[model samples]
Target: MPFIEDFNNNHPTFIKNLLKKSPGLTQREVLLCMYLKFNYSNREICELMNISNSTVDSYRHRARKKMKLKRTDSIFSYLNQL
Candidate 1:
């Protein structure tokens, strides 16, 4: 629980490093992945990113594919475990 707070606070740096390590991911994909890491819903992501819901979905889907994640896998869980 405490680490969640730390992770949330340091998320930008963490996300930056994560994106750096993920060569296949785009900036938008990294942004979406970071939001997803915090368990943000599509509506919340769209609102924060000033994007459409379908755009959010597309980014997430593409991110998942680029990361080679299974469709059933939780992106939040995967990122957190890293």
Candidate 2:
């Protein structure tokens, strides 16, 4: 996985605990969560992941849904709390 190595290297504990808490998350979703946890902007995420803005938005929405977050909930705050 392209981002997995960087994510694992930079945030092994967060990724591990996130998987424990939300094991249903896919690897890509975990990567999105990791970026959000770091307060990365959508533009930054898009640039780093070499994806489109819409793709980043889609990932954020999917990740939030998978995490059972409310529409108004903050993904960053939730991940930080985890």
Candidate 3:
């Protein structure tokens, strides 16, 4: 996917470390995390991914769980740290 290529090109190290840290994450989840890292809102992600708002929420929740994030943790912060 173009978005994947773009992200990979722009943030190669972050992507590598993220995959190493959470190997179980699906491609979609990784993509979601990238978007969150860039501070994309749910509605923006929905439009960009051609998915519904609820689907975006689900992806966020699942990605958070896979990343072992606490409930109070910010996904943006977690991704940025990675």
lDDT of each: 0.77, 0.83, 0.87
> Where does candidate 2 clash, by residue pair?
none
Index of the highest-TM-score prediction: 3
lDDT of 2: 0.83
Better of 1 and 2 by lDDT: 2
Q: Which regions in candidate 2 have their CA more than 4 angstroms from the true location?
A: 1-11
Q: Which 10-residue window in model 2 sums to the lowest lDDT?
A: 1-10
lDDT of 1: 0.77
Q: Sorted by TM-score, highest first, which candidate order results?
A: 3, 2, 1
Write the residue-wise lDDT of candidate 2 on 1-82 in tens digits.
6556786787668877888888888877887888887788989989888899999988878888888899888788899987
Q: How close to the true structure is residue 47 of candidate 1, measured as C-alpha lDDT? A: 87
Q: Distance (Å) between predicted and true CA of 7, model 3? A: 2.3
Higher-scoring candidate on TM-score, 1 or 2: 2
Of 2 and 3, the candidate ranking higher by TM-score? 3
